[model samples]
Target: MTPFIELFTPVSIRGMTVKNRVVMPSMLTHMASVNGEVTDRLAAYYAERAKGGAGLIFPEATAVDDSGLSYFRGLSIAHDRYVPGLKKLARAIHEHGSRAGIQLGHGGRYAQPEFSRSARRLVSYLPGISPEEDARVMDKEEIERLAGCFVQAAERAAQAGFDMVEIHGAHGYLIGSFLSPFTNRRTDEWGGSFENRMRFAEVVIRGIRRRLGPDFPLSFRLSSDEFLPGGITVDLAAKIAAYVVHCGVDLVHVSAGMIDTNRFTGPPPVLPMGWNADNAAVIRKALEGTNALVTVAGRIHDGDTAERILREGKADLVSIGRALIADPWLPHKLETGQLKKITPCLSCNEGCVGSIGKNRPLSCAVNPRVGFEQRPARHVENARKVVIVGAGVAGMEAALTAARLGHAITLLEKDSRLGGLVNIAALPPHKDIFLRLIDHMSHELVENGVKLVLGNAVSAADLKAMAPDVIIVATGSRPVIPGFLKNSSAMTAADVLSGCPTGQKTLVLGGGLVGAETAEFLAAQGKEVAVLEMRDEIAPDMQGRARAFLMEELSARHVKLMTGLEVRSVDGNGVVIVKDRYGNEYPLPRYDTLVAAMGYRSEQSLCAELTREGMRFVAIGDCVKADKIMAAVHQGYHAAKAI
Candidate 1:
């Protein structure tokens, strides 16, 4: 018996029946060739999700016209030459009993000029903060031409054997630019009045309908709320949703925010789960009389929430993005009543969204085998004894990987608990999502038959006693304290998170991710906190969406953030004096405790001690280098596999 019956039930749009309500919505991977051709890596990525039990899979937004290309490696459907690659992608998804779909998009004024090499087309002349902001205002002829491009793209999608094609009218793209009053200021037929503003989308939709006939499934992705002043509100978006359904759209996929407010588009952990469900419900209500099904996407990561949305008629389907990236097998696991086995997406945004923004291929912090789906790990036929020290993410992941390959594994941790640094990382506000990763990985380790020994520190003698064939050390890291404050009463951020006592007023040094988060934690505890950094910005190493929300939270809590300043000296009484970049000395506000969150140093002591006894072991995670979780996890999995 499958769980979450509503999610696994079949649903039909136009004549296409999707096996379930779990939709893998379009998300950029940047896995295509530089010239916009589909690559084997991209196909394999989509195929994995389909095999994982998704009802329908929509590939990332494909450009309808070359002049509207947004990403350098974005997929394209502008010309017939691209049909073969798109066909292969569709076949890959179809082979796994999943319906394949593609989103057709044109970036409009948001298209990167470097790659497009053409003036961006806009509904009206938007005022520029600089001269380069001037874009080409589309004339009536140009509008018709672009509408034809959309129709051609839909035709190509049908020819490539895709089950459906979703028109990308959300996220401040070409169609969204014309629909939103905030960007469309023209008095022409394409803008001004609500009906006029929606003309472009209607034209494109009607054109596709005429070309593909009434039997083909068509989905319109609508931005239910622009979240901007003078933008399309819920009421307005509902009317537009009705209009689009009337204009021949079989489904309305509701999303939120525009390009300027993209943080809400791919929301990080700071945002609420299923944040856009309410707006999607509004659209569903508006389409009450139409044969249009609604799908909602935005930070939704769980079966309970997806089930509730469908049960309450908030939406007919849930389009999950980042969650599927973290674990493609999520839907399959949920269906088989293995919810606990599903690897939860941390909503960290450091991997999928952050990596693509940096022009790198998509990846997940919790799941290392994201982009490299084509290369599957091989199981070893001859099992060997493997001993792993530390039960942190790296160590646990290595243990599970090796154990699954038929290796006899034993995992040891000095601390009573698992998770290592992640246990402390989850202490900050809205960061409890990370605890899910810890829970999932730990459970998986046990299920894979990896022997777990906690509250015992591994020594060289222990390795010799066990006589393991392979040894892995993932002892993690320790906080770095400045030399001048090493002997003082200064405590590390880890100390505070570990329930160490602090005074009413606290000063946190090092305004990086750890320091800012520590400041937030202290403020929440009713402590008047301040963070001082020698750099110009706080949390510079953090991802964009998470950093933005952290700054907002700090300001709201009245936590002082002093940048371009360093600790000059501290008197015997612990009264600290600070200096700015200009060498101006000043006394800080009264504070009883000072916490050092400067950074962390790799815990390499164990590796060296083991070497002295002629024990060869591979070090992973912070024990190798004090970096992000991705590096640690990747190193651990690959290192264990090689052995």
Candidate 2:
């Protein structure tokens, strides 16, 4: 019905056809065995998505040779043992009318020590790249062997019933090293000139085609630009695109670099989101007369944008990495005219990219069901009567997840509308992304039939009146103020955040994450602000990169912070404080708002009451113990699974 629905329609590539336009591109699911065998968990995970109705599934990068894999868990086609499980996965995908494709790769220089890191010893010398080049480089014989390995992988893909094959030539991997001026320094036939630079890459493409023939649907993922000055520019990328298209490739998958230089280019505030489409489009134009599909994305959230890009000829296909993690059903929901109901990707890069660097599995900050969808929330399976007190993030997620599983639910909120703290929390500077979660989760609960009870906490009497089979106490938390600190005009950070009414030239109490961020928010509002904290450091709890950015931003905004200070009392004009760190006492002029951003105390009393009622109870959100959204969302999901 919507334009987005058209994007979800079936499309054919070469000899194979997919059920929809949506493609879950190659992200390392990390579900492979250490020895490279795919497991049941991996197969079932892909099957669940197939059953959920994805058009095509390109399961992670499949290393073509043993030395090519950089990660211990990366899937590989280097051995025949990888075939049977690949067949099983292919079958599962086909059962849902979807096609499966394997992206074969080789990590030349960036080999992980965890997987074949020692194998780099056998590689040869580098010739032209930067000083950071790994001493180990592939020799001519190794290049030839890897080419054959790629062909073998192609043959195996076909034997295992894969619909197509994509060559992993981007992301600063081995293929990328051979392509980038900054990484590949070979002087032989495989390096030096632009033609030499593309030699090894073209060899892989030509080799796979020699094995699978013309109609096998071979796709090549190419980094459009190295993002560095001496790096492969869009100009060089066009030539590279032309070369691959001429080598019998059926698709050109455009992407950018892996690390430094080409990291975040294209768009502003580009950790991820709508930055790479223009580059993908450039690649698409390069192959205008050729018969090849072009796909591009660094960050794109929700279905409308995906469809609009396709309709506008921005890219033949749009690949979503971050958004899908937020909500796997994004495409299906879009196809069914449910765009507004979709939970948008925040593009925070918190768990997805950040955690990946830390060597943990990729995850989404907002969507807890990402990597562990095997045991997703079971709504009210038996249609039990459930009454949930306090509608916050955790309670909302609980109610929504439970109701979807077919439960009769009543969500009680003391506030007139949902989004307990989110309504105010999002108002802080740069908290727009955090705010989106509230709107999304609230919409999902209300639309999916969670009954709303407004204007009161569920009193003990009210709980008895409901006589529910299940009761969830999620009354949330309140700010903590230390006894020694005294500002008569002071209010909790919630009051300032609520924008109820605060004076100017105020001293914010507490120099933690909330205090720092609130100070940043206030400074942006052109208010003179100063912060007083008892600790030595400020915003110690924030993520490293984000914290750095916040500090730089606060500094630029002229926000003042006084650490190692203890407040004794507050008068109408100012607050009395002692700085033991500096051994001095002074009354900083406040005149306006005083805030307590120290911390929150759990409302476990309500949870204890429900526990004594002999009802199946779960306490979530701030009430269960205040922490980050990660703990809150996961607790809500797993807790519902208990029922």
Best by TM-score: 1
lDDT of 1 by residue, 344-449 (tens): 9988888898788889999888888999999988788888899999888888888888888789999999999998998988888888888898998888888888
Query: Candidate 2: misplaced stretches above 4 Å?
Result: 120-135, 260-273, 350-367, 371-383, 428-436, 483-485, 488-599, 608-617
Task: Kindly list the per-residue Cα lDDT of model 2 for residues 28-135, writing each as its tens digit.
Answer: 666778777777777767776777667778888888887777774778888888899889878977887777888988776666656764555222344443224333
Worst 10 residues of 1 by lDDT: 126-135
Model 2: ten consecutive residues of lowest lDDT: 261-270
lDDT measured at residue 643 in model 2 versus the true structure, 0 to 100: 62
What lDDT is reached at residue 97 by model 1? 98
lDDT of each: 0.89, 0.74
Flag regions of model 1 displaced more than 4 Å. Answer: 129-134
